[model samples]
Target: MDTSQHSMHNLFEQLGLPSSEHDVEQFIRTHRLFSQDIRLDKATFWTESQAEFLREAFEEDSDWCEVVDELDSRLRS
Candidate 1:
């Protein structure tokens, strides 16, 4: 298996949250998106630093972008 893909699956950990899949799912389940039209970086659940990290990762198109996008998709879903 590609290890990079495996790492992408741990989106919560990439965002400095618990690494476990269960914890990640629980966190997603509990958090609400600020609005359906709002981006993940604008979501109310994250701290300012967390939001900044996400915005930077996305703007830079860094390796973390995929995971961050995944988290955004999951959260919005």
Candidate 2:
């Protein structure tokens, strides 16, 4: 097996986060959302869509929970 095939996904698994298409993409999005209403410790530049996504994720705070829960459920299955 290619050990690095899903390195990003695996890292996310370690953090209990789902793999994003690109870390930079998520990085950019997360801070942009943060910038909308708050000055973040880490600054970023992302499009409005990115900001929307990060805002949604922050509001729901469920993507990671679901990913972890899904992994557990899969293990059970």
Candidate 3:
């Protein structure tokens, strides 16, 4: 892999997060749901949307969580 991809991959693995370029890009695109920052990419996204969905699901399975999971899953595929 190129250094850029390797660097992005290592960073996510270190954080115990998904690191594939596609997944990372997806997570970054949806990050506005969690933070004020708009800038995101494979190099900076670390949080797992699936984990986030599960946490919110604990509050009771809402449509929002379902949508979130579906969105993330779609991106992962």
Best by lDDT: 1
Per-candidate TM-score against the hidden true structure: 0.77, 0.30, 0.34
Q: Please, what are the lDDT tens digits per residue for candidate 2 over residues 20-48?
A: 65762463354333223442212244345
Q: Which residue pairs does candidate 3 place in steric collision? A: none
Q: Could you give the candidate ranking by lDDT, starting with the highest?
A: 1, 3, 2
**Which candidate comes out best when scored by TM-score?**
1
The 10-residue segment with the lowest total lDDT in model 2: 34-43
Better of 2 and 3 by lDDT: 3
Cα lDDT computed for each candidate against the true fold: 0.76, 0.41, 0.47
User: What local lDDT does model 2 show for residue 64?
Assistant: 40
Poorest lDDT segment (10 consecutive residues) of candidate 3 = 35-44
Which structure is stronger by TM-score: 1 or 3?
A: 1
Q: Candidate 2 vs candidate 3: which has greater TM-score?
A: 3
Q: If both were scored by lDDT, which would come out higher, candidate 1 or candidate 2?
A: 1
